[model samples]
Target: MAALEAEIARRPGHNIKRAEQALMTAKAAVLREFELTVPQYAGMVVLSYLPGTSGAQLARICAVTPQTMATVLSNLEAKGLVTRTPSSVHQKVFVTKLTRAGNALIKRADVKAHAVEDRLVAEFSDDERRLLADLLERAIKVLNG
Candidate 1:
């Protein structure tokens, strides 16, 4: 623990990366119980909020390459959780939506995911959580810019 703290103190990015890894590990564990990968889970969550989104849009939103998103969508389609249809507005575009099965699975998965989140934040006050979120967002914005 002391060595880890010392290393992270020397490189702050290590702290952020480690935190992200831990969060992803926890999420993956919960998601696995539902037979979903992290990307698939993320895609479904996005679809729940924005139904009929384009594959390109989902790829951007999920921070994955278009090819990776295509594979994720294909896997979800094979699992009968989502469907992709040719867009009426764009002949070459395919829009994706969560099927009823996807909706139900996500609803259940969210409960488990939220439990992991709640456990992660259990030691923090509400204000601290907000501050952490803001700082993370700012770091992302700076890195992106």
Candidate 2:
């Protein structure tokens, strides 16, 4: 085999993009009963854990368009999962947080998320998983830079 083919074969069976797709699919399957998109579910979970968050902050954290965040906020609001409190001083700024329902949703999602995560990294040892994550993070920083 060519050197490149040999190198490719030495790499993990599932590439990053394929693994991401599997993760999204797993999460979607888990969230199907909740009638939520992945973005909405993730946004709500973030809000639940981080109080006094803003829509702009959420957009950054979730790495999505502000327009997408707006749509997610709307959906979450409709589902009674998230709430936005207007700033008394700055009318343009809103503080976002998760409701009781949102917290509950995250708790449920966490179970399924863990299962998915375990399955995804099953082939790798704990140290390998950590090393893989660190390498991926470094690559992401370099790409973003």
Q: Each candidate: what lDDT? A: 0.93, 0.82
On residues 63-128, what C-alpha lDDT tens digit does candidate 1 reach at each position?
999999999999999999999999999999998999999999999998898898899999799999
Give the TM-score of each candidate. Answer: 0.90, 0.83
The parts of candidate 2 lying over 4 Å away from their true place are 1-14
Residue 98 of model 1: what lDDT?
95
Clashing pairs in 1: none
lDDT of model 1 at position 25: 92
- Tens digits of per-residue lDDT, candidate 2, 30-105, equal 7787787788877877886787788889999998998999889988888888888997768988898888888888
